[model samples]
Target: IEGPDLISKLRSEHGVSVPVLMLTERRELSDKIRAFRSGADDYVTKPFDIPELEVRLQAIVNRAQGRPATRRLTDGGLTLDLATLIASREGRQLRLYPGTRKLLQVLMRASPSAVSRQELEHALWGDDPPDRDLLRSHMSAL
Candidate 1:
């Protein structure tokens, strides 16, 4: 049997959930369908872009780890998508600077649980720790 066939056997016999992306020279609708039916998460033909493949693998890892690919946070009708860094409130977008966007992402992910100022500070500024008032300024801006 071929690679796809072997993969199907592994899935059925071992109950493996690891994402599989089939990269092959075989390009046919039936081939692709068979791979998917056999438990492949993705299928890519030959001559594909490397960067795009990397993105797909990252998405698989993210899904396996239970982290949302979109990386979204919502609270009180405010929607923040960290992937695109778009923040919206009540279906309307709130223009946010990059720094403000980062601030909102951290805060929303920790929703229902208070994140210490120090934690936020570290998230925003890393080890350098910004001036004491900087975090307050970002919050106010948000």
Candidate 2:
């Protein structure tokens, strides 16, 4: 969860309905914009006040809970339904194996970047060591 991809998974796969409050020391405007674009609801720069941070988080949580339901997800030409875990690209439903489906979901959520082999293995196998060809097979199938 400490890795960069964690945020995307939290937002996309886990369906975290609450706002995300990111705490970072980065001072650049581009960095802040990137964090927001990557699904952070709010970014708190470093050297922050604990009380202020708590208050902001509380406000965000309250507001999110009061909002309407969200139904659809679209990334580029691909669309997915969070309720059904169904995905389609360019109006065609992509047939995917169960494992491959899960892998695709993770990858799609973290699109425009490469997800490390270790991250995928951990997601699919947990703490146990998976078969050497497991990921390769899944990727190929995908």
Candidate 3:
């Protein structure tokens, strides 16, 4: 089976919102554009200066950890403040468990489109998934 592109898989399939710096040997403009359009925060062709590469990587890291996008997502009567990790419905704060809150954060950010089970599993469990249907249980709670 053919797998998706690296950036596309990471962003669309894995729900990775962090900054990405592409260091590739390809120098074609099309490659650069494809990377950017695929959600790469920055791209550096091969034969890059060590110092410049370090600086660029650092810049992306700082940006990733710095102020988040001032985005407030809402649907119907539900409200989500991404920067604050707060969710409410009809102006009343919803008392959600920590895991549920985290789940909502992921869900709200992935709004208008269904988030893949792989992505949800990533959010629920970084790299290790319990043998049981733990993610489904948490989702059911929410």
Candidate 4:
């Protein structure tokens, strides 16, 4: 993804539930850290073996699909219906934008721990990234 902002938009707007695998030639440790902080589940350096990538993709998909997963999560006054994408607090619906909904889902899943920025960006933008400033604007608006 080239546009940092678009990536942010996707993370904030779409309820992307899968892990993002970054396929890139950049191998610097700093780059890796940036990717993870952006919300990437895994980062594969370029010139990688195809077989290994396939296996990794499968594993990520399986985990995301809830193969051997736990059900239900409740925190504070909110209850999340993961399967149905419904979240409510005290039987009252909490209004949310599309991006906020996705953000909530990720945050709820990673409760008590900080979700990486890279992971969030990947979930939002995929391979075609957007401008960072634009993303920041959207987030602020949200």
Q: Which scores better on TM-score, 1 or 3?
A: 1
**C-alpha root-mean-square deviation, candidate 1:** 7.3
lDDT of 4 at 3: 24
Residue 5 error, candidate 3, Å: 33
lDDT by residue (tens digit), candidate 1, 14-111: 98878898898989999999999989889889999754575577578778899877556789999986546678999999999767877777788788
Give residue 1's error in model 3 in angstroms: 43
lDDT of 4 at 102: 59
The residue-level lDDT of candidate 3 at 136 comes to: 77
What lDDT does candidate 4 reach at residue 18?
53
- TM-score of predicted model 1? 0.54
- Give the per-residue lDDT digits (tens) of candidate 2, residues 27-115: 79987877777688888988997545644664576578784343345779887654455778998987776677667656765777889
Q: Which candidate is the best by TM-score?
A: 1
lDDT, candidate 4, at 135: 48
**Whose lDDT is higher: candidate 1's or candidate 2's?**
1
Q: Which ten residues in a row have the lowest lDDT in candidate 2?
A: 65-74
* Ranking of models by lDDT: 1, 3, 2, 4
- In angstroms, the error of model 1 at 137 is 0.7
Model 3 collision count: 0
| Tens-digit lDDT track of model 3 for 1-142 | 1112777888898898877888888888887888888888998887887546644664676578794444466888888765455679999988777677667767876777899888887776778867547777788888
